[model samples]
Target: MADSESGGRPALARRLAAEAVGSMLLAALVVGSGIAAVQLSPDQVGLELVENAAATAAGLFAIILMVGPVSGAHFNPVVSLVDAAFGGLSWRDAAAYLPAQVAGCVAGAVLANLMFDRSAVSIASHHRASGAHLLAEVVATAGLILLIFALARSDRAERAPAAVGAYIGAAYWFTSSTSFANPAITVGRMFSDSFAGIAPASAPAFIAVQVVGGAVGYGLVRLFYPPTVAPGRLVSDPRRQADAPHPSRERSTLR
Candidate 1:
C-alpha cells in the first residue's frame, strides 16, 4: 500500500490549506517576535536574540504538531522538494505547496509589520551578505534537513516537532546568519526591518545556498539509507510472509 493510502492522505486542497496556514503562523511568529524582542530589549542584542529564538522554537513546535498530519508541515520549499525527491510527496503536490508557502510567509510578514505599526512592505535594510554568511546558510540548512530526515528514518517522526524546534533554536545562535534555513522565510524576512529580517540584496544568496544544502543533505540520506532492492518489503525475515507486506512498508521505504 502507498503511504498516502494507508495513512489516509487529506485532499490536496486541504493539505495546501494546512501548508499555507502553518507557514503564515510560522512567519508571523518569527517576525512578530523579532519586532517585539528588539523593542523589549532595545540595548541588549543578545537578549533580543534569546527572546526571538525562544518564541520561534515554541511556535514551530506547536505549528508542526498542528499541521504535520495534513501536509507534513513543510513550510520550507526545500523540505517540500526533499519529500518529493524521496517519494513521500508527489512533484505536482510539491509544486502547489511551494507557492502557497511563499505567499503565506509574505502575507505573514506583512501582517506582523502591520501589527507592530510599521509599513507592511518595507524592504529590510539589514544587509546579511558575505561569504561567511552564505557558508553559514549552507551549514544551517544542511543540518536542519539532516536532522529532520534522520528522525524520520529512525522511526522517530513523532519527535520531529520538538527536535526540529530545538535544532532551529540552537542554530540561531551558532550559525552566522542566524539560520534562516528556509527560502520562503528568507524572502518574507526581506519585507521586515526588525531583528529577524534579511535585506533584499541578501535573500538570493541565502536561498541559493539553502538549496545547495538541501541537495547535499538529500544525498547524505540516500547514502546512509540506500534504496532497498525489494520495493515493498520491510524486512528480509524468513518467518514473515513476503506476500503480506507490512502495513507501514511504503512509508518506511521513504525512510
Candidate 2:
C-alpha cells in the first residue's frame, strides 16, 4: 500500500516535526538493514545489494506515507533543497528542513548503533570510502534528484508517490552507487561500518555531487515546466484597476 496524502502545505512547526521523525526512521532502517545484511552474508555481494535495495524501498515508502502529509515527506536535505530551487517550496521551509534532516539522520544512526550493540556499530568498515564507491554515490544521487524534480514538476505529482519508490529501487540496481540518493543517508550510513559505511573524507565529494545534482534537477524542471498559471492572476492585479475606465465617463458614454 502507498503512504501518501492529498494537497496542502504544512506549517513550520508541523513540517519540522515531520522531518525530525521521518529522518530518524529513514536512518535507522538504512543503517540497521545494512548491518543485518552483512552479518547474515558477509561475502555475498548480490545478497547485500538486494537487501540494501529492499531496505531502501520499504523504509522510504513507510516514511513518505507516514510523514508526507505533514512535511511533503522530504526526508532528504537535497530533496528539500531542490524543491526550494524549483519554487515548489520556500526558503523558509528549507531553512527549517535541512538541519532537521541532518540531525535526525545522526540521531537515527546512533539509535541503530545502540540497538545493534556498540561494538557492532560498523564504524570501522574500510569499504566506506573507496574512490569507486564515492563516484557511484555521485551518479546515483544525481539520478535521484532528476527523478524527484521531474515527477514533482510534471502534472503527475498525484502519481508520484508510487513512481518515486519504484524509480529509486530501480536506480539502485542500475546506478553504480546502489542509489543512496541522499547525502543525509550517506552521512548516517557512515556511522555504520557495515556494507553501507562511507568515510568522513568521502562525504564532501558526495555532498558536492548531490548539491550539484539537486541544482541541475531544479534547473531542468524549471526549463521544462514553466508554470502556466500566472501569480498575478491568482491574486487580483491591482494594476488592472489603474487601467479601468472611470465610472463617470462610462455613464456619460452610455447616456
Alpha carbon lDDT at 214, candidate 1: 95
TM-scores for all predictions: 0.88, 0.79
**Where is the poorest 10-residue window by lDDT in model 2?**
229-238
In candidate 2, which residue ranges exceed 4 Å CA deviation? 1-8, 119-124, 127-135, 230-255
TM-score of 2: 0.79
In model 2, what is the error at residue 106, expressed in angstroms? 0.9
lDDT of 2 by residue, 1-255 (tens): 223222223357776878888898888887788778877878998998788778777677766767765667777888777666555567887888888888888788877778888643456344435566566666666666666555544433434456567777787788766667787877777776666667676676777777776666656656765643211111111232334345321110000
State each model's CA lDDT, in order. Answer: 0.81, 0.65
Residue-wise C-alpha lDDT for candidate 1, range 113-169, written one tens digit per residue: 999999988888999989999999999998888887766665456677898899999
lDDT, candidate 1, at 163: 85
